[model samples]
Target: MAGLDFLNGELEELKRQGKYRLPSVWESGSGAWMDIGGRRVLQMASNNYLGLTDHPRLKRAAVEATEKYGVGAGSVRTISGTLDIHEQLELELARFKDTEAALVFQSGFTTNQGVFGTLLQEGDVVISDELNHASIIDGIRLTKAARRIYKHKDMDSLEQALRESSGYRTRFVVTDGVFSMDGDIAPLPQIVELAERYDAVVCVDDAHASGVLGRFGKGSTDHFGLHGRVHIQIGTLSKAVGVVGGYAAGSQALKEYLIHKARPFLFSTSQTPAVAAACLEAIRVLQDSPELGERLHASASSFRTRLQADGFDTGVSETPIMPIVIGDSARTMRFSARLLELGVFAPGIVYPTVGEGKGRVRFIVTAMHSDEDLAFARDALLQAGREFGLV
Candidate 1:
């Protein structure tokens, strides 16, 4: 058979296994309600947790920056792409994170790939949570380091892994501040204690935690009050902040080392001036407006409470990323399709993004969603659950 034929066969097998993914197209801006495939739908599937994506301040910043700097940065950051706006964004991020310095990447995924692959070497060890984001997993794979996986949120298992890798030159313990799939928080306090005891550098990917946790959404470190203990904090401006880019907050020396040695930062073009300017404005908006965060939390809590009361299994959720468990992948898809038909846009998450037999319909609440919107969504979901026998 031809190689092309073999690739087609593999794709067919994935479809048969209920694992093939085809994302829907959106034709509108990020908001509480969105236009999906030309239809208006209540959006419960976006990562815009704080609803800053469409904020007036961010839009204005982007517009002004575009007019002043044009569109693209035109070259790699190391050469001529490093604009004044990029430096300003970095400064704003460092201040927001309360770190000495920060380095911005084109995207969050590349940030992880750059940081892990560049920093770790052949005799080093990476002790990672089993449920870490795919970027981290791929980053670890790219490195020559020995990788160890500890059970999710199992501090004892992490400690054991650390103890077993004592002879390595460097040990890195990495975890997500918020487990994206399960919508659960990391046991950061315990993890930090373990890292300290084992002399391990702690790294947290706060992709979902930033702009949704702690006082004014300072992220997991601030939420747990372990700010200085976390060696590296990875955050995305695209999610809660409503812009496009990722940043790593750390000491000045670490930021300098990444800027010099990290392949992604060295090779990739810096973020567009518009994106960086928008991100800076986003940070300011987040700091100035506490109401947005409160509304988001209140909506999330209401949704969680209603779902639990309605007999839905929202697995260990402590944040806006709520997962309504539906064990069968096909059933989950049907539930999602039914939701779409009912003018709601919550999507079914299936393997291998999640584990087998753990398929769920993930609901992401935003500050823009009103009480009426939440009720509409809740009623739609409950109806879908009944229709699909998921309840």
Candidate 2:
């Protein structure tokens, strides 16, 4: 058959299996409210946890940097692409993470890909949380190392994998700082203890945790007081920092080695000067203002309490990333549609993003949302649930 025909056939199969996903288009900047195809809606699907995406400080910094450095880095870091701004951003990230060193990548996904593929070799083993983000899984797949998956947040299962991998030349336990799907925190302290006992390196993907958890938002390691125990700390600037790109924090030697060996870092152009400068400003904003974090947590608490009180089945979510479980994919989709009609913009999350029979409408709260905004969302969601016969 023709190539287009084959592609269409695969897409049809995916649709028939209830696994095809089409994203909605948004025309405005990310905030508590957004414009979706000309309709204004209360956005509860963004990872802009701290709501800094359109902050004046970040915009000014980005604009100034663009004027000074132009649009792109023009080359990869290993070649002549390591701009002074890139170095500054790396140093700032290292200081913020309290790590010996840091390395910037084109994105959070590539950071995982580069770090994991560079560190693990044929005889090595990677024990990862089953629900880890796709980037980590893909990164492991790119490596020659053996991969073992443990039940999500199950320390005993992780220990078993670690114990079974004793013969491997190297063992690394990888997990998300805060599981994106369920919004539950990883048992990092237990994982750290196990890593020590098993002589394994512990790495955490803090994509969702960096700008929302810990004191001054230092991420899961600081949240659990693990500090120097975590061998690798990966995070993104696109989420709460409300910019673009990603970084990995670790010992100076590890970063130096990745600089020379990691293909993505060596081959990809560095992040634009505007993005790097904006990220730096965002970090400064987070550090100087504790009110943003407090407001975000308060909004999350309020929403969670109201949802639970109204009898919505919110799973074990302790963070701003909450999910209203609806089991059936079609029903979850319908629920999200109803929510959209009610002027809320949370999207349905179905299989592949989650496991089978675990479809839900994910709600993300932001610090920029006022009490009225949250109250409006709660009312809208309750109405949608009742209309859909969910509650």
Candidate that scores best on lDDT? 2
lDDT of all the models against the reference? 0.91, 0.91
TM-score of every model?
Answer: 0.98, 0.97
TM-score of 2: 0.97
lDDT of 1 by residue, 305-358 (tens): 989999999999989999999988877887788899999998889988899899
User: What's the lDDT for candidate 1?
Assistant: 0.91
Where does model 1 exceed 4 Å of error? none
Clashes of each: 0, 0
Relative to the true structure, candidate 1 reaches a TM of: 0.98
Residue pairs with clashing backbones, model 2: none
Off by over 4 Å in 2: 16-21
Cα error of candidate 1 at position 259, Å: 1.1
Write down the lDDT that model 2 would get: 0.91
The CA lDDT at 334 in model 2 is 79
